[model samples]
Target: MSKKDKNSSNSRRDFMKTSATALAGFYIVPRHVLGGPGFIAPSDKLRVASVGVGGMGGGDVRGIYGTGKVDMIALCDVDDSRAKQSVEAHPKAKYYKDFRVMLENEENNIDAVSVSTPDHMHAVIAMMAMKMGKHVYVQKPMAHDIYEARMLTEAASKYKVVTQMGNQGSSGDGVRKMVEWYDAGLIGEATKVYSWTNRPVWPQGIPWPEKGQTPPKDLDWDLWLGTAPYKDYVENLVPFNWRGWWDYGTGALGDMACHIMEPPFRVLGLGYPKSAECSVGSVYVGEFQQGYFPESCPPSSHITLRFDRPGKEDLEFHWMDGGIQPTRPEELEANEQMGDGGNGVIIEGTKGKMMCSTYGINPQLLPTSKTKDINVPETLYRVPKGDQGHYANWVEACIGGYGSKEFDLLSSPFSVAGPLTESVLMGNLAIRSYDYRAPRKENQNQFDYPGRGIKLLWDGENMKITNFEPANQFVKRQYQGDYSL
Candidate 1:
């Protein structure tokens, strides 16, 4: 209503329209820099809009706002019930049920975007924001598919925007310390790595519900489905259980590997796996019948990924989920715990071994006694507040603008996260391919599962499976309806 307020609103609208038409390839400058002459200053807050604001997303909202240097300009979510807390927390922010509407209306008003939606929707939302020249902070497992991860990585570079993945562990001190010890030759050359988790605290390895229920009044089921195939609403599918499904979620591997496997990936400087193989647990529906559900992720799985190390022998990495764990090390005491009892990682080398829990916490040498005595120098810079600082790190970097000192020091920039995500998704790729079946040539009634009992050779540069032609379908999923990268 005030004269200054109206003028300020008009200026923002004008700038957004002009930028959309004329600044297609230009980097978005800091908001303070947009003010002419006497109005220029560096104290302006970084304005942010968030797409998902419940569960893990709510945590992201609070973390970024806690930085005291950001303005929560807008919020969007498909389910109002899930987003209640976030909407109430930031009453000043405009709220919308559709992200596309939120972005179109607020594009000029916000400086950055925080994408905390489900796995499948992450890529499309993040890509649209990057194309609009807004900095982005996407949650872990950067994308649902390897191709999406690669595209997001390339978009970050092309758009020249500051970017960070939501794997808080990437900014933690545990990983940095492990990096230092590995670099100091304390562990010699890491030859084998194992990471495990107790996940699927939700349902998996099951058939789609034979029945569908009416969606809740507050939930827009269609928008929530987004890129996933259209399906009738089912109970217990929203909020959290979706992680077990193949369409909307990436199962346990995508849900937790970004946090659990990050330490080894960072310590060893890993890239795409040269080959992948996997075996999955099965459920029985009757005395003689095994449950075959392609729509859902398997109940439990053990994935082996082979990574080539230039001149040295290939590194063997193993990932286990559904409460599975690796063999106990001889160096560890009989009574000692491995990986905090539930989730953990073990990096074995020629000389010694080291271990850590999820989020790279509580890193220790195999002997445990040697943990305190080792003398590896702390060479890597520790992010302030460690993992808890993840959100603030991105906020400060956005305020500092792309290519600034703050941006350069980001912990999980897409350049690092993209490769990490691709490696993580490879485990899922192998798992899905394990169930690929074909009809027998002689006996039409009998099926020959060709994808089973085989190692899929990978050509990382081309993002394709060199040996198994059918397995390549999982590389980049087909989008449903109008949703796309």
Candidate 2:
């Protein structure tokens, strides 16, 4: 464009990169021109923006905008082909392939951002926006690694920006009901919990595609790679299927555990795990031996985590993927579904077991009829519209400003979500640890899986694996290119 616009683009990066307080003056205009945060003329709307407007991210934007509560100011995605639909739908919103540039140029115009990128890129993108004092609503897992999760959890309050993770079930009435049930001791202090999902439903337990593909002209390959290692474009890795790879995705646990396990986290008021162990499915590449795919996640895994409680012994939590299910609790009717067909959660207490389907949508106590027989007074405020109101909840929270009741009332703000995501991903770490490989010094042609089948102890406050030193490296990955968090 014009000379003025070109200069703005060049300096936009630095402008948004600066501290939030330094950028506050630029936002006074929305007030000066339209009045303050409370001034809603039916013309006023939350100035919403997004990083990834393809896949589930597109759904996030559509839902928020569907509320007719926000102005779709800008959209950013590295792949134009993936973003085509959103661009067409929000034609008036400016577009960019790089989020940094979008933030630079649109910081003054954007009040909040939805970060719905790949699991690896979530924390960095959200951190940048939050540092600039923009509220953030990020998709689940909140972060790809434990370190990133901890940082984002802390950044939310330090920046004083409204934040929510896109684990919609966090707002669902079912989870709140479970919380109420647990509070009334209906389950008699949950000691063990299990959550499982049927996923990878994408590919896993395989080597990367041996050959590279021609990068589509519309896709900015480098920008799409973002914090991931620079590699030649691989076929079928984009649009989806990245979930099975470690560099970009958090595997099935990251993909679905947030929805499946959120209830237990809330019900028990859980914290970081003290130790984790896992067993994974194997891929038979030959007649005799199993293949080890370090770059890719295992096809399935069963991970167990123990969390120490104050007065009690500890909470044991189990996570399973790839359709694996825990033993059927004896209390349930044989015909009753275990975990909503292929996906579900179960909490076992001293007195009984409680179960639910995915996203904590359905809650039924074992022996089938306890839900109605034992009623606990509602203590928690229910999110309006249940899970469907998740998007609007953040929209209103952003409008109310951080520290307001709406902000404090968020169901999955980073404060709560970050720890929850970290706890969920700890399972992945144990899974990954089971597959950790090292080149054998004595035999150059072969590798060794030294981390397998070990109960890796964790030191949560420090974000370390105290018992398994080799697995500690996965806690925080080194960023390629210029990105850092």
Candidate 3:
């Protein structure tokens, strides 16, 4: 797909007219420029750059490079050694220790950039790319905080740049089919959703390790810290464990919720919850605590969120973590195993139920009886055959054409906003209130916002918390000195 093919005739005409008006001397042509017989190729092959070259970033680089249609022109990472694979993968590409410098030096060479950086840096970097007229694909949770998410969304619309959030599950055919199933009343008006994860394999909550150990020779600690407030470079926080800390990441919810909670949030049109609060087990409060947080950042945790349905009265949704599955339905045989690990979502309706894993790609109906029966309603949309590769979907969108209404960020506000905010931030809230005493062993199942924590009325359109001033302030963080929001 190329820009010529991506925009329809009307869109191309509008773009050309806009471009011509913006640049007085440039002549705009609506005709597709040809590079081969009967072929109008991309204006030029997309020259791509990647930031944050370790872990998820490394995987993203591989995916984009595999397409063979893009030129992996630049790779950037604070840790030189961690960027080795990317450097090897695209031997001809330039390497940079800072993304800001890379953008400054190669502003005109790149067509798009993939941001696999931590949650905090997502908005800043993506905004820079969009301002430069380059398309952007950033990893999930979209932004570090609610304010940044709103800013990124607005910027994308303002610049009219092709944008994709790295909730790759959004591209799955199974997700779309599931939405169709809900629309056709298979699950019968999905009033409640439960999604959970078991993550943070890295050490967290444990006392910070001694700081005397030397930093890796290839690591630039200062650049890696970027806009985050200064703190000693502890060995425990680096390489991968930052997800558990509030200063750097949003814990397990931020790490996995975007993918797992996507299906229900989208299909059910679950807008913002009226109020959300967190409850946890065995964590103690501390003197330095500024908000509700888990006492010790436990390896395993659980959180539940409640919402008032638009016209449906009170509707509740619960999330459990630490490999804890919800009470198995009694209809199943006593010996049946509960859902576990990676991630899963359970939607319980007034009638029967439907459950699936993160991508919903290979979902299974409840009760083994349903699986064996041939009378199940035919799935509304046929699940697209074969792997509809995540990166391919984004790249295709970037090049123009082959778009999906169901998966587009703009098209699925409920899918993107509800889960993105609740999953990640709810964990943060739980961690903040970690010291709060739980009244029972199953606090997550019975946690109440109005009874204990500050109750907030969310105004999604204005991105404001209407009820509590303190809670509104909490939505946006104070930038470190010399760093701007």
Candidate 3 local lDDT, 1-485, one digit each (tens): 12222232123212111221232353323326422211113444567899987788999898877776788889999888888888887899999998889998988788788999877777788888878877787887777777777677667667666676777666666566566556556657666777776665665554444364567889888777776777667765677787766667766767777877776765665544555555544333354332233312555566656654545655566766556567666655787543444568878777667777776656655774674442444443221232346676556546542122212322222224433554356445434532234554454322223322554455555656566544554467776655553
Rank the candidate models, highest TM-score first.
1, 2, 3
Q: Model 2, which residues run further than 4 Å from truth?
A: 1-43, 287-289, 434-446
| Candidate 1 local lDDT, 1-485, one digit each (tens) | 12432343233222211211232354546645575321112477888999999999999999999999889999999999999999999999999998889999998898889999999999999999998889899998889999999899899989888899999998888998888888789889999999999997999988889799999999999999999999999999998999999998899999999999988988877777889888888788654235646788988899999987766899999999999899999999999999988899999999999999999999999899999998875666667899998887788778766765566567888877888899899988887773434443433222233565799898887899999887888999999988777
Score each candidate by Cα lDDT: 0.84, 0.82, 0.61
**For model 1, what is the C-alpha lDDT against the true structure?**
0.84
Candidate 1, residue 12: lDDT: 23
Give residue 41's error in model 2 in angstroms. 10
C-alpha RMSD by candidate, in order? 10.0, 9.5, 8.9
TM-score of 2: 0.89
Instruction: Write the number of the candidate with greater lDDT, choosing between 1 and 3.
Output: 1
